[model samples]
Target: MLPGPADTPPGPRLEAAVAAVAAPDVVFALSRDGQRTVRCGGTAPPPPVPRERLRYELGSASKAFTGLLLAELTRSGRLSGGEPAAALLDPRRRTDREPITLAHLITHTSGLPGLPRDFFRRALPAWHTNPYARYADERVVDAFLAYRQRRRPGTHWHYSNFGVAVLGHALAAATGVSWEELLTRHVLLPLHLDGVAPHPGPAGTDATGHRRDGTTPTPALDAGGFQAAGAVRGTPEDLLAFVEAHVRPSPTPLAAALHAVRRPVLRRGLGHRHVHTMGWFQHPTAYGPLYFHCGATLGQQAFLGFCPGTGTALVAACTRRFRARDTFVATAYGLLAEP
Candidate 1:
């Protein structure tokens, strides 16, 4: 079992950082040198266990998990990402552009758009609340089919929820199972991350969200077709545990895969200075390459990252996604990248 967040107290820097976020409730789970602690702040009181277990929507940080699943499947020889993802589609129609491989999907180089076409048709109605939840799985597939590739696959990097969601479907089509089951079997269960649930159940959670006011409640996004993109949700503990596994992966079920994710896979941004690993964005610092990915639901924000060089893992979660969410990201990144 991982060490509990109560084992140690956070440093002054972490405490002040957590307190700065404009949230009614927030938690910062920090692990360093194998010790961990959770700093709670904001107007709301610290949530108890179980309620605290799923209180934050992980948003795009979920891509890290998807990256892990892709690595594990590739490691186990389940589905070689080299195969064209189109083969897994319903009609399996060939496109005029270069064939998009499964690898391209996970790497965000599939030449797919950021969103599926006609997404706004349904999303506009629920723009402020759970937009992706309106795009059902079948409709998502149809959207993929309707889109014509504007850029050549593998030529450039463009983050696309459409690509990853399609990859989830392709994996399911290949394995004859759902992405949820695949994630549970190969990633979550093996890692003991039972709290990172994408769907709701009888056991209600304290994971509700709030708008910018930090008081008005906002509906949680239980993504329908976009589950693979960003539906993962859990407490700061759950996220810290996940990142901790990467920090010291030996003996873990996905140790090799975990190590593989940190290696720079693609380079992007100005002068190719930014690094893209299988799961996280890589930024080199005096400490080392800091790997991280952040996400936000309509009302909540989350940042997850770790630096192997400095041996740090940080998970920042909050109920309100204020306009200054980037400030939260900068603060979290500072915590991880601090030498």
Candidate 2:
């Protein structure tokens, strides 16, 4: 039987912190001091949100899962993180700027810019529609090959959707399996997380991503070329479950790989300082050292974080595009810190 809220003590303070933010849907789940698992907001009676209906877009947060998959592939000897990314792709199809490694892709230090310069310019008119939806895989690959580099690989950290997309391609080539299948088999299935899916568009119950104005709904994300970067969708409860597994993980290699990804690679700055480890961001918090990640698309906002010290993980998903301002992260940390 599913555990009830009584078995899982609620973090009222965390709930209040989320409430203060006025987020459309907030889900705080904690597993501390044994089998305790408490959920507030999303699943409560007179529910702030319908538990089964709200599907989060996951934004860049999808990188964490992709990172885990890559780590697993490396652990199994199917792929190597140290190898240059160009080695996997056709040389004629790769950019000559510099050697981009899988590690650089995972760490977001590959010197690749965040997004294509014309991505917005070209896609803005259909901004609410899934712009990348119509672009074929060949188009995505061509964009990468045609693009020029702004800096040397591994010299600095700049989040790049294209970099991760390349990693996805490499993983597929190495494993001879599609990225979606790899994620489903290696990550979701092992964790028994049936709620998570590569593309939420076909899932009739998935939540709709509303524009910033909250009046119009955006097209469901196109997973064709963006699956590795930001295409997964799931409910807040499922996300919290995934975090719990990370906190007190099993002794298997998958769990070990997850821990390996959390190791700090680069110093981002004080409380807000960050280390872009495998797929997640490591940051210090009042609750103790925590690994967190937030994602934003044109029409959605999502935050997923877990405090290992307290065995607490909180996930907040909203329909409208919310700014990833300091206040957003601070608010999440505040909820996680409450005892």
Q: What is the TM-score of each candidate against the true structure?
A: 0.92, 0.84
Off by over 4 Å in 2: 1-11, 33-49, 91-98, 201-203, 251-253, 268-273, 324-329
Model 1 lDDT, full chain set: 0.80
Q: On residues 1-339, what C-alpha lDDT tens digit does candidate 2 reach at each position?
A: 122233334655445554544444444445554344444342123333464346778888888889888878877787778867665566455445467778888888878777666666766666567776655565566676666667887788777887787778767766678889999999998888788887764545676666655556676777557678888788766787777777877754378777777677777556536666788877666556788788876667777877788777777676566554534456665555554
Ten-residue segment with the worst summed lDDT in candidate 1?
A: 1-10
For 94-148, candidate 1 gives per-residue lDDT tens digits of: 5444788888988899899888878889888888877888899988878887777
Error of 1 at 84 (Å): 1.1
Evaluate model 2: give its lDDT. 0.69
Residue 242 C-alpha lDDT in model 1: 92
